[model samples]
Target: MHRFKGRVGLCAMVALGVVTACGGSPDPARPAGEKQQEQQAASRSGEASPGEDRAVTWANDYCGAVSELVRSVSEMPIIDASSPRRASETSGELLKVMVGGLDRTLDRLDNLGAPPVDGAERVRRDAVATYADIREHAQAALSELSAAEGPEASRDAVSSVRKPLDDLGGVDLLAGFDTVPALQEASRQAPACRTLTDADPDPRIDSPGS
Candidate 1:
């Protein structure tokens, strides 16, 4: 249980690893007329130009899926260690939530097609593979927790859960785009991705009202 607490603390930090997208700076030399023409063209096309629209769509969807995952994981219940049964029950429920969240995120990633940038397929494939591993570990932890019968067993099961959560905390979304400038720019334009920017770098949970 002690080890789990240490690892669980990383959950927030890991979720916060997503790169925050920043809006691009306006061109100082471009003529206002050209900007207006671009806007008009976009409006006439029903939205942005086809290429731009696809990039934004992909970015937004990606960010939204990630946000859902962070929220679900963040909702992990504070375990009451005083009672073995209660601890097991709460921990089990958290595993269920984690599994469900992972499952949904995996589906979304699978259907995202691919990012709209160079090396898009490789990035998408890597992300899917990594998340699949995380999900598998989570399922294994759930099974361990289910089979645990006593305090020592329960503690070990919880430790198993934390190992993956700790690894998750080390995930760095920006690292994945180290060579992809266009993908980084798309992330900056994506409004949903701002959650990463707003995330608390050192998050702490408060007990009930104290």
Candidate 2:
């Protein structure tokens, strides 16, 4: 029910790993242990049924996959602005990495199917739809980036996916599973899986290579 406000740049940080980039601590708002406790209490109260445990587990697995995908691409060489050809090539490679990662992630999610929990059908449906949008839009953004002539153009091209990526980050797929402690903790660690406030600048996109 809580909506996060900010540019998709923040989501980029989540995908990219803010801690790795900024050498910063995790978001202060949701400490892991405390969040787990809260979620456990909620679960005990029957806010989320025991059957939903499987859904929570699946959600956590999905988040882990996303985290890995982001980390993998964030390590790629930054595009050099000084050389136009190199910039284009590097940008294309980065986009290719992103496309491949997203495709794999989406396919994995599809294969996993929805959790066999009561009242989880809707959450599963929405999560799948949102992920599909992310994949499609990311592919489109990759095309634009590949066609871009230079660094500035590539930056602009990459910016095109900001909205859809933001939407992907904003989705609350685990809304139904929130009462599950593990799911809550997992969501906290990976803000892209749900809504949350933005932290300081910790860009995923590295500076141009020297």
Candidate 3:
């Protein structure tokens, strides 16, 4: 029932590195030896550092999960406002899929832990908070739909969460990588992560009314 909006603007903002939560240049004063160590580690690992690699890896996985969830939501049959029972059933199933996907995504992020690079801790915290907020909103929407007694009430319940859901749709999973030069460069080199482009728009769910 909640109407989500175009995430194009959010994606554009992210592409422009305008996310204050994760925006900043890497520290210029970092020791030269540290850079050398990172390069040496990259050689030994034959890939990015553990932290940057993990961030890219998890980001790719999260993107896949989000894509699948979007596909599922898009494929769902639209329910009539007069068919409250059908709406409830369909919405329940959709929310279940969404909540599960979000949980798994969060779990992967948690397991990956924050990137160990300088100035990345705050970005990681913000990313995790954003994911948690989306999950909370989804749960709340589900609860509202479940508690509604009739078709009109159910529609109203769904409508109430529209903005929250829209906000979730606008979240940029890669926002955390913007501030870390190492991660950004690594993401560019990684095929899986690199495939995600500024021009690639986020997947969207249609409003219930549509």
Candidate 4:
């Protein structure tokens, strides 16, 4: 992905993770298409019954956030690109993995409508850990990217974030929503999310849910 699309957004961190904070929008002329897609995706959440669309939308949005980061990292440095150049950027792309993972997790959570009050405790605990893992690795990469300037370092830092996510793949998380499906769905959730939050948001239309 291009640098413009590399940094990530803190949607979950702002809306769900921590206290809220307001801010201005991105470049208006840069491209309204992405914004429009995001709006459409958000609106979709409100459109269907709680689980109907939220699971897919949220998951896709979440995954897309990280995917954008992945793409950003992947695209960083020209083999000659400066570290400061790459590191100074990427909140847009890198953080998306956590955001996307949370989004997808939330969608499953909403769908399941909170696990049982008994063993459900374990699920929540596990989820928090999962989310934390997502956040930690992403943050680590971003921090390294921010600090380094060499293309090799920038690339290495960004690539470092990939394995953790790859390890997270196809976990059958969210009650049979396999990692592949969840990631694919999350990827396909919105045109805008894809336009902005994803490095490669192309729908895996080959699979019905992907």
| Strongest candidate by TM-score | 1
TM-scores of the candidates are 0.68, 0.47, 0.60, 0.36
Q: Which stretches of candidate 4 lie over 4 Å from their true place?
A: 1-92, 100-117, 175-210
Off by over 4 Å in 3: 1-82, 198-210
Error (Å) of candidate 2 at residue 99 is 0.9
Q: For residues 1-210, what per-residue lDDT tens digits would candidate 2 score against the true structure?
A: 332222232244322221121246646896789867866777686564434444444554565444444443444455555665665666666556656756665665566546554444455555567667766776787688767876678668756645544554454434444544554444544445542323322222221221
Clashes of 3: 0
Instruction: Estimate the lDDT of model 2.
Output: 0.51
Ranking by lDDT: 1, 3, 2, 4
> Which lDDT tens digits does candidate 1 get at residues 57-84?
5766665665555666666666666777
RMSD vs true structure, all candidates: 10.2, 14.0, 10.5, 16.4
Worst 10 residues of 4 by lDDT: 201-210
Lowest lDDT 10-mer window, candidate 2? 201-210
TM-score computed on alpha carbons, candidate 1: 0.68
Please state the error at residue 118 of candidate 3 in Å. 1.4
Inter-residue clash pairs, candidate 1: 21-188
- Cα RMSD (Å) between model 3 and the true structure? 10.5
**lDDT by residue for model 3 (56-175), tens:** 554554444344334444444454446667667766666666677577656755665444456556655676688678779878888988889877887787675565556656666467
